[model samples]
Target: MRRTTAAIAIIAISVPTVPLTYGRSQVGGARVKQYQEHLRTVLPEADHFVSKGGEYPHFRGYIRGTAGEVDKLVGLAYLNSDVGHAITGYASEIVVMVGLRPVGTITAVTVVTHNEPYGYRSIDLARFKNQFPNRR
Candidate 1:
């Protein structure tokens, strides 16, 4: 009876630990690398990004030189979920990363993630995505 109780306790402790470790690994894994690529796609001019803290968080885009970042601000990039929490697609939320010039012109908009059933035929198309860039 004591052995059985000890085994049960060990299983309970180990089960939760596995998921926590897995979750942390994922944060630093392929998905994060892909998202960084997405950010670069939208804000190609920015060689470096600095997170700006606010009620709605955003990245201040900058061009890094041999010394460091240039004083001139290039653009801004942010996720839609940070500003538009209530927006959702058919299956789930459609997260987008938007880049803008200093003058507020949209540089580009890229869909970071979406789960809509027919999204590939529409939202994933270059024609649809192309419309956002250069827009106010």
Candidate 2:
């Protein structure tokens, strides 16, 4: 007999309705680096990120080529807000970053920030985040 487990990549927490303020002109170079660091946690194979615009805004993660140029597409990273989801947690909206493979499987999910009081304890646990990886 075989047992199967289903994992939903979506997770909710709490966050304020504010646009991201991470840009070279707004928050300085260090802030951008910090944001990228967060992104790397979900898409470790990505070495370069390019912002893509559309109904579902996302970042195209790419890997560097042999000659030190970014040429291969690795995965896509996007925030829940980009998909226009009104999903909220205990307090408010939960901002989460999700990395997905081209074949529609989830690579990983990372909670960028949250405003949950009690929920934080559970959401912050590694096991909670670990369950999201390799799921569809």
* Leading candidate by lDDT: 1
The superposed Cα distance between candidate 2 and the true structure at residue 71, in angstroms, equals 0.5
Against the hidden reference, what TM-scores do the models get? 0.67, 0.68
Poorly placed runs, candidate 1 (over 4 Å) = 1-34, 65-69, 119-124
Counting clashing residue pairs in each candidate, in order, gives: 0, 2
Please report, in order, the local distance difference test score of every candidate based on alpha carbons.
0.70, 0.69
Model 2 whole-model lDDT (C-alpha atoms): 0.69
Best by TM-score: 2
User: Model 1, range 26-136, lDDT digits (tens) per residue?
Assistant: 332343344578768888987766665466767677776556644567898777776666457667777778899999999998877776786454455587579998889
Q: Write the per-residue lDDT of candidate 2 for residues 2-89, one digit (tens) a residue.
A: 2222222221222233435531222323333556966798788988877766566677788878886748988988777667674587
Native-to-model Cα distance after best TM-score fit, residue 14 in candidate 1, in Å? 11
- The residue-level lDDT of candidate 1 at 106 comes to 97
How far out, in Å, is residue 87 in model 2?
Answer: 2.5
Candidate 2: TM-score? 0.68
